[model samples]
Every structure is written in structure tokens, then in C-alpha cells.
Target: MAAEVKLAVRGAGKRYGEMDALKDCSLDVAPNSIVSIVGPSGCGKTTLLWSMSGLHGLTSGEVLLDGRRITGPHPDIGLVFQEANLLPWRNLMDNILFPFEVKHQKPDHGWIAHLLERVGLTGFEKNFPNELSGGMQQRASIVRALSLRPSVLLMDEPFGALDAFTREEMNQLVEEIWMETHTTIVFITHSIEEALFLSDKVVVLTPRPGRVLNTYEVPFERPRTMEIMAGKEVYDLTYRIKADIYGQSRMQARAAE
Candidate 1:
């Protein structure tokens, strides 16, 4: 009857050559919950995501999904990166189905169609990536990630490249999709507002060799509205997180000098 522990990182660490990207990082994600990772630029947020997705091997510790070790890129996990990364030659439908094609499997047309509609790309199936706006293309990429019904969705700055309005729209769309599907999500971003708006739990990280500085629970009720962000509670929490992140930067600078 209890919610399951969907994904976990235990004593996880990553390094590239002489540079340590993450150190002693650990977190747990519950099924059907959304967790956001936030930090300043170059804080190893992407490295953490790569480790979770098994795209990069960790220097220490482990990433577990459903009690099993994630040794490599598992099929049950879906990832959406900063760029839409759609195939220029393939139309929307084909691009969305590209994952299935690569695995020599047939895609579920019914579900694919439904996802297209959910992401507002219903009639644009035949259109190429170049033919669509940046926001539309990103939506298609998101739908593609979700079309596979991944048990865990890993998004690394998926909307970071979009304009302000588009980013906010996509944030709402993400919330809608998460509510509908109940899929576990680990979203990484640099924006405090984005983290506060979309996360059930926001994990703050330190700079360079990133470490968990704090984890804040977002108490805002869902089916969240834009107006909710204007409340005193929301502003206070955002300010707190902003202070924690900036404070860490100052500490790091002091240690360096």
C-alpha cells in the first residue's frame, strides 16, 4: 500500500580526469514524485544526471532503480536533454518513434498519438523539426521521451534553452503530464523559480565537485497555478533557496583564497 522507492543514488561520485564532478552525492526518488536538482552553473548537475541514466560510469558508489543496479543505459529510463535533438530528416512521428525503431520494436501507435495530442503536436506529425518553432520542437522531444512510458524520467535542463514564456508553458505542461502518468521524475535546472514551481522536492548542490547542500520540500498544493507563485510562502521559500546557493558559492570562494 505504500509508495515504492523508484530510484536511488548511494554515495555516488563522478570524476573526469583530474576534475571531480560530484562527491558523496546521495538521493532517493519515490515513485510518482518529482525531484528537481538546482545549483549554479558548472556545479556538476548534468554529471549527476548522466550517472543516474548510466550514460557515465561513476567513480564510486551506485545508482539503483527498483532495487537493481543500473549498470548501463536501461530501457525503462527516459532522458530529455537541453537540446530537442530531433533528427532533422525525420518527421515528428518518426522522430518520436525513433527509439522504438532503434530497438527493432514496434511502437504503440495509440499511445504515441495520445502523447502527441497531450504535448499539442497533434497534426504536426508529418512536419520536420526545422519546420517547427523551438518550443514546438522541444514539446515533440518531451513526447518522444514519454511515449516509451519510462518508469523514471530524467530531464537535464529540458526547457533551459527556450524563451521565458515558452519555458513557463513547458513547465506547466510537465506538471500536467506528471499528474496524468504518475511517472517519477528527476529534473535538473539552474532556475530557482522553475525548481520551486515543478518540484515536490528540490535538492540544492554546491559548486565544482557538487555535493548536496540541502533538500527543500515544496509545500505548494498541486494542480499548481501561476498565481500560486505570487504568494508570500512561495517567495519566502525561493528566497531561502537563493540564499543557500549563493552562500555556498561564497564559502567555496573563501576556501580557494
Candidate 2:
């Protein structure tokens, strides 16, 4: 059976003064499914994500979470950005607990311990952000976002700053966590490989005034490994997505001219 839809974007449009960033884009994300949005730079990928998260309002249409329109950010959603954004002054445990601390809620020590172990940061709780590697910092940020037990997680190029190897490691860790927690996720990334590796559905968008170009359903099974990326199917899909992105850029350029 298909998964239940947990989030929906209906005929969404976004504009910044005279410039249109997104137009008539619609998508449905399933509960516990990982959906990744990818496109050429400046294609409104981030705009669409923010609109869905209710951090930015759409010019038209609506963003729905569990059938209710999202007018603003809610506690049910968690967001992670390109930068880890951990407070350098706070140690790892305190960083992960920051959200609870700010909300004045009692930290669930057991759950926090499990999260630290799940991300392989158990012993580094007292260590500062600078003491950890880039990947480690990102891990802390992710756990911190999950600290609230949000049903939906929005990640915008969270691992984009890490080296390729570190990025792959982080991807594996994310997949592992997703398998365990099954949180609905909307991830935005520029890398086709990363999108394919992490997403159940990869949504491609057109350049500025972005619209949905295509949504590819990944066929690979869960607990995926690096070897799957080298397979013929993955290679073909990667090539096709790259070609489509380039093709869209060419078409946009010609239209501008």
C-alpha cells in the first residue's frame, strides 16, 4: 500500500516584488518518506522549501501539513540549514538540548542519550563545536532539530559544506536515523547523487519561477550502500537528471534572450 500523505503543496506560487521565484508548484510528501528537491542554482528550491515549512509565505495557493494549511512555523516541524549553526560556546550535549532549554521544557535525558548514541556522539557531549569535525557538528545540529520529536523535518543542504567523503558518511548516518525514527523529511540539495541516495522521491524543478519538472521515484531498497550508486540504473538516472537540469538552463537562457 502507498504511504499516507503527510504534507501537501497545492498550486503554490511565490514572488519577491516583480520577480517570481516559484509558480504553480504542487507536491505531496508521504508520511515517514524522504523527499528531496533538486534543480539548477537559483531555481527556487530553497524558496519552495521555506514556503512549505511556513517560514516564508506563498504568493498563491497553500501549504498543508496533515490537511491543515500551514500559515506559520509550528512545533511539529523541525528545520536544519546548510550551516550546523551550533552555538560555539555551548558543548555538544547542551547544543542538542538547546531547543528544550529555550522552550523551557524538561530535557528528556534518556531520549537525548539515545540520539547522541544514534549519531555516534555519545562521548563528546561536553565537547565544544570547534572540537568536533564538520560532519560531527552537522550531526549535532540534526539531533538538536529532532530533540522536539517533530513529525516533519526540513533540511536545506545540511551536508553541503562537508567534504565529499564526509558528506557520504553523513548521508549514511541520516539514512540510518531515518530508518529508525521514520520521520517525514523534505530535503533540498544540489547534488543528484545525494538526492538519489537519500530520497524516496526526487523532485526536479525548473529554473526561476520554478515549477515541478519531474518527480523520480527511487527504486532502490532501504539500507542502501555506496555500491548502489555505481549500478547501471542509478548511473542512468543521474545522467538523465543532469541533462534535464542543463536543458532547463538552456531553455531559460533562450527565453530570457
Most lDDT-accurate candidate: 1
- Please count the clashing residue pairs in each candidate, in the order shown: 0, 0
TM-score of 2: 0.95
What would the per-residue lDDT of candidate 1 be over residues 1-257, giving only the tens digit for each residue?
Answer: 96678999999888888999999999888888999999989999999999999998999999999999999999999999887989999999999989999989889999999998998999999999999999999999999998889989999999888999999999999999998998999999988999989999999988878889899989788888868988888898998999998998888789899
Candidate 1 lDDT score relative to the true structure: 0.92
Give the TM-score of each candidate. 0.96, 0.95
Tell me the whole-model lDDT of each prediction, alpha carbons only. Answer: 0.92, 0.92
RMSD per candidate (Å) reads 1.5, 1.6
**Candidate 2: where are CA atoms >4 Å away?**
1-3
Q: Quote the lDDT for 220 in model 2.
A: 95
Residue 136 error, candidate 2, Å: 1.0
